[model samples]
Target: MSSPLRLILFDVDGTLADSQGAITGAMAEAFEGAGLPVPPRDAILSIVGLSLPLAMRELAPGQDAATVEALVEGYKSSYMLAREAAGAGHSPLYPGAREALAELNAIPEYLLGVATGKSQRGVEALIAAH
Candidate 1:
């Protein structure tokens, strides 16, 4: 007999919303906050799917590892600040996102939960905003 599956796990970042603009903006703010030169927004966009620290390390290659770590922290700080100031109004759900979720929720056999590297607070905030 096959094991029953009761849940559907979704990847939250790009799968749920287009966060690239906000993410890149926050990265730019982080660079300025850290007194480092801001990298191109297109450069930042290429790293969107990564977790913060790994993206920083990859994007800021040739910087000291410790400094990269600090930059990551700055990025998180800037992101959270921007998030608060933006008041959860940004990060709209992707086209078809709500309709799809509603359709899935209507199915008795389906249960939805996200499997994401985002912190619980961040995920909750995102979902609530949308």
Candidate 2:
């Protein structure tokens, strides 16, 4: 008899790997690119799960929609450039994560996947690098 299937979804940042440093750097770059003051690291990290536009809105409250969109674009560009510069080794996996994942993936009932706030391209690149 075949085993029943199960699914496991993972978040990218601060979960599978530590991308906070990269995120902070890109966020700062984005804010500067948009001619806005860079928010503190805690403030940037707080809205990590939000979509890009919404995150930009929270970062630059009271800003108009156009400004938020520009900030989002800048963030995306900075983040992509950073990932391209560093690659799979950019973000380190949690300790023992490789062994754990291998153990989990060995089970016929388990299937792992990702559910991150990162753009599809970002996630793919991160996966390729790390």
Candidate 3:
């Protein structure tokens, strides 16, 4: 008798990868580039699970569309630059995450996947890095 397939989805940030530094730094740079006061770390972290546009909206409420869009673009640019500069270590996997994933992958009944607010490119980069 064969076991039923089980799907396991893990979040990228704060779960598989410890990306708080990259996230907060990009957010700060984005707000500064947009000439806005940077939100505190906690405030920024509060929107970690949201998409960039939604996150910018939450962080900079009442801002016009153009400003919000610019913040999103700035964040993307800053994050990409940081990632390029730091390479795979920019957002390293959490300790033992790789081994855990490997173990899970080795199980025939378990199918592992990711559920994250990160962009497709970002996810790909993380996967390629580790």
Candidate number with greatest lDDT: 3
Better of 1 and 2 by TM-score: 2
Model 1 has an lDDT value of 0.80
Q: Report how far off residue 120 is in candidate 2 (Å).
A: 1.5
Lowest summed lDDT across 10 adjacent residues in model 2 is found at 121-130
**Cα TM-score per model:** 0.85, 0.94, 0.97
* Model 2 TM-score relative to the real fold: 0.94
Model 3 segments beyond 4 Å from truth? none
Q: Write the per-residue lDDT of candidate 2 for residues 18-53, one digit (tens) a residue.
A: 888888998999999989999999999999989988
- Window of ten residues with lowest summed lDDT in model 1: 84-93
**Residue pairs that clash (backbone atoms under 3 angstroms), model 3:** none
* Lowest-sum lDDT 10-residue window in model 3: 86-95
| Rank ordering of all candidates by lDDT, starting from the highest | 3, 2, 1
Best by TM-score: 3
